[model samples]
Target: MKRLPLEGIRVADLTMVWAGPFATKILAEMGAEVIKVESPQAWDLVRTLIPMPGVEEFWNCSYYFNDYNRDKKSVTLHLADPRGRELFLRLVERSDVVIENYRADVLDKLGLGYEVLRERKRDIILVSMAGFGKTGPEREYVGYGPIIEQMAGLASLTGYGDDGVPYKTGISYGDPVAGAAAAGAVALALIRRQRTGEGAFIDLAQREVMATLIGEAFVRASLRGEVPPHRGNRDERYAPQGVYRCFGEDRWVAISVRSDEEWRRLAQAIGRPDLASLTLPERKARHDELDRAIEAWTEQIRPQVAAQVLQAVGVPAAPVIDTEAIHDDPNLVAREFWVTLPHPRMKPWRQPRSPWRLAEANPTPRRHAPLFGEHNTEILGGLLGLSQEEIAELEAAGIVGRAPVDARPGG
Candidate 1:
């Protein structure tokens, strides 16, 4: 088999929920061995967030969990316990990278901070993703994706102009954005390590990274003490840009008329040739009117068909694809965005493969998520040189186990 870019990398992933797991998923897709350590005492909350009615191993069956956790091994360990700490450190000593998304204080409190991990293995790269940074004033504030959006000023920038209130995205958009950057951070740290033979401690703030996307807004803030005005989907640079509703149930098309030529092309395409020669400034001044005009034409057509019509005439347009529709999108399918893998406990569903498609070294998912501690004997005994009796002793001592005792989905 042709080796992938990250084929030799091993990561001890202690992240739960979206941000951390999303990053590890990318690494796994790029051909890294990811050991996901969880605990019976307080497992990943997402495992039980939406449990199926009577499924026994609901944790292993979650679409959300499995989506991000594919191609990794799950190992249950209580890090608060001394034995768990010792075992985790043992794993860390052998791991090339360690990732966590716990609160700023959690890792150090667990006695597994970057300094301590570096002591165990001098060149161990550590990526810590807190909502804020470890040393910021906002570090202690509890933040999920929505909170991150608000804190990062993204929410303030998203809303219909008529409404004074800001609107949050329908989904937790911050998680995946931060996750993608974290994956890149891990790769950069590895590259730096290759040059210097030293490890890096990456302090990634979720809100800060989310804020970086709007750097021009920061310049506006500093130069003129300006806060961005909410223009809904409209951009300051592009006039007559918005998402318009189409014929079907909640279907919409996003259109951006960048130049006078695009506006004329779109106008002609939509049979509004009388309004074809409107300049950018004129379009900007009458954006809402233009939106209504566009929607009038679009409401009679399917979003996909409308987008294609606009695109055929050189307008930048696309359908606002929803979850189910996106899975069936021909472009994404042509790009091979989705994949299905068999799992022993669950039937196959569409899961997104990594977007980082390396042409020469194409990485593919090798296995479903490992059954809880499925490689205990192989990893602890074979890799760590523990004798069979010693392994038995460790299991007997509550140092390791396949499943969590008294484990409910989240419990």
Candidate 2:
């Protein structure tokens, strides 16, 4: 097999929750060695975010935690402890990168700031994913993905016109966006370091990354001094574009008629032959009537069938696959987009493969997320050259553990 791009790269992952872990996940998929460090006193909260009923070691069994954390190793180290801090710095001296998504003041409070890491390893790449960045006026403010979206002005643009209430996406939209950006930043920093022989500190604000996605909104506001009106699923440019209900309960298909020809095709596909010649302005004026006509035809068929009929007639259409049904999506199945990996704690289930498919390198997930601190002995003894007695001492002192000291029923 060909070598992956990050085959020799090593990443010290100190990120918890979604944003930082998502970024390191990409690196791991591309063949980087990602060592996820969590404190025994306060391990990643996601481990117990949703505790499984009647399950021992529920932390290791969390599907939410395992899904985002596959292809990585776990090490327990309480940074607040002086011995643990020293051990982490020792690890840093041999690592190529250290990434974290703490609040702006947290790293410095623990005395493991960029400057400290730089002293340990001169060429260590530090990627700090603070929610608002380190230098801004709101740097000290704490936030998560939902708050990031509202603060970034994304939520302001996502509401139905009638209700006048902004709606956040069903998922945490800002996290994965920032994660992808952070991964790219890591690649760019690696390139620059190769040329300059210097490390980099990437101060990525999640809100800033989220805000960049709405550039067109900014441009329109700056030029015309107008806030874009909430249009729900309707697009001003594409008349008669909306999600319509299909036959099954809560099943829907989204249809967009971009060009006049496409609109004509869509009209005929829904058995409205007389409306095929309607102009753009006419369609815009009668969008409600067209939607009713479209839904009448759509409600008679399954979402997939409705989508297939419209798409076959040259109209842009797609069925909205829900969480459960998405697992059986034909296109994804054909592309082998999901892999089922064995886990020590959980049963094998289909998990998403890396979306970044390099035809030559063929990067694949190597293992499930490590059992809590599963690699402690391997890393401390093999990689860091610690003696068995020394590791045992650390464990006896509650400095390292296989389970969280603060573990409870739910996180």
Candidate 3:
């Protein structure tokens, strides 16, 4: 295999939940050695977010945790303990990057801030992904992805115009967006270190990253003093654009007419040839009536069939695939976008391949997410040159463990 871009890089991952794990996963895909450090007393919450009923080691078997955490090693360490902190700093002395998404105060409180890390390894890159940045007034506030969306103004732009209400996206939209940005930031930081031999402190605010998505909305508010009105799925540039229900239960197809020519084609495709000559203004005026007519035709066909017929006539259309149907999507299947890796505790299931396709390097997932403390010996003994007796002593003292200290049903 060709050498991946981040080959030979070592990262100490001090993140949990979606955003941090998602960022580390991208780095791991690019060939970084990501050691996920979790304290035995306080492990990643996602491990037990949806525990499998009556299953042994349910934390290790969580599909939610396994999906985002593949291609990384797990190391249990109680950072609050002096020995664990010493070991972590020793690990940091040999690592290229240290990343965490704790609140702005947590790292300093743990005595592992960038200044302390730089003392151990002067050229180490520290990427802090706090919900708000370290210097902001809101830096002390805690926030998740949904809260980030609302604070970033994304929620304000996401409702139907008629409802006078705002809606957050169905998924935790801010998380992956910030994760992708943080991964890119890490790459850039590495490049800077190579060029200037200087370390960097990247203070990334997740809310700021989410706000970047609505740049046009900010421009409108600033330049025209206009708040962006919600149009739901409708685009201002396109008329008669909406997602309509199809024949199957809960199945829908999204259709858009960008031009008069496409509108003509769409009208003909929907068997409303009489409406083909309507101009853009006329179409805009009658979008509701057109939607009703389009639905009258669409409700008789399956979403896929409706998408195909409309697409055949050059009107932009696609089926709004739900969670289950997405796994069977033909386009994704043809592109080999999913892979099913063997897991020790769970049956093989399709997981998404890295979307960052490097034609030559061909990054692929090498292993499943590690079981708790799976790499404690490999890292502490093999890398740090600790003796077996020393490791056993640490484990006995509750500085490291094979499982959480007080495991419960819900994490």
Candidate 4:
């Protein structure tokens, strides 16, 4: 097998829930040794967030936790405990990166701030991903992905024009966006350290990352004193662009006519050659009428067929596939977009492959997510050279263990 880009790098991962875990997962896929640290008394909330009713060891069997946390080692540590903090510092001495997504004040309050980590390892890269950055007025505020989107102005631009209300995304949109950015940030920090031989403290604000996604709105707000109006699926630059209902219940297809030529093709494809001669301005003016016309043709056809027919005629179109249907999508399947990895606690289920495709050194999932504290002995004893007697004492003291102490959802 070819060596991956991140091979030989070791990361001390303190991230929990979605964003931090998502970032570390990407690093792990690229062959980094990611040691996921959790406290026996205070484990990652996602572990038991959605408990399996009849399952034993519910924390070890959460599909949500397992899916995002694959290809990493889990180590239990109570950072508040003096001995646990000392052991964590020892681990950091051998690590390349340390990352977390706690609220801005949490890490510093725990006394493991960047300055303290720098004291232990001079060239260690520390990444802090708070919903708001560490030094801002909003730093004290706590939030999850949905709240981040609303505060970032995305939800403001999401609702249908007819409705006087904003809408959140179907998923936790901000989490993965921040996660991808954090991965890139870690890579850049590593590159900088290689040249300058100095570590970096990356304070990544999730709300700021979310705002970067809709930069054009900020430009409009500044240059013209305008706020982006909610237009649903309609684009300001393209006419006759909308998601139309198709033949089946709750099925839809998105179509966009970028140019007058594409509009002409779309018009002719739906047997409206008279409308085909319309210019961009005319199409823009009659967008509602054009949507009705397009829907009339699409209502009788399946979404996939409508998309195919329009795409064949040189019009931009695709079916709006739902969550379950996306796993079986023909195009995605052809591209080998999913992989089924073996998990000890559960049956093999198809999970998404990384979208970052490096043609030469292709990355693949190496292992299932580690069970809680699965690597305590391997990491503490093998890496830190702690004696077996010391390891047993730590386990007895609740500094390291396989199961969270009194673990419960949202506790």
In lDDT terms, which candidate is top? 3
What is the lDDT of every predicted structure here? 0.85, 0.92, 0.93, 0.92
lDDT of 4 by residue, 18-124 (tens): 99999999999998999999999878999999855677888988889988999999999999998899999999999999999998999888889999999999999
The residue-by-residue lDDT of candidate 3 on 120-147, one tens digit each, is 9999999999999888699998779999
Candidate 4: C-alpha lDDT? 0.92
lDDT tens string, model 1, 1-411?
Answer: 367888889999999889999999999988888888887666777766665557887766667677778899877677988878988899998899999999999999999998899899999999999999888688876568998888888887888768678999898888999999999999999999999999999999999989998788888999999888888788999989989999989999999988888899999988899989889888889987888899999999999899888888889999998888889988889988888889887888887776666778777666776666777777777666678898677677666776565666644
lDDT of 4 at 118: 98
Task: Estimate the TM-score for candidate 3.
Answer: 0.98
Q: List the residue pairs that clash in candidate 2.
A: none
Off by over 4 Å in 4: 409-411
For all predicted structures, in order, the TM-scores are 0.93, 0.98, 0.98, 0.96
TM-score of 4: 0.96
Worst 10 residues of 3 by lDDT: 402-411
Query: Once superposed on the true structure, which residue ranges of model 3 sit more than 4 Å away at CA?
Result: none
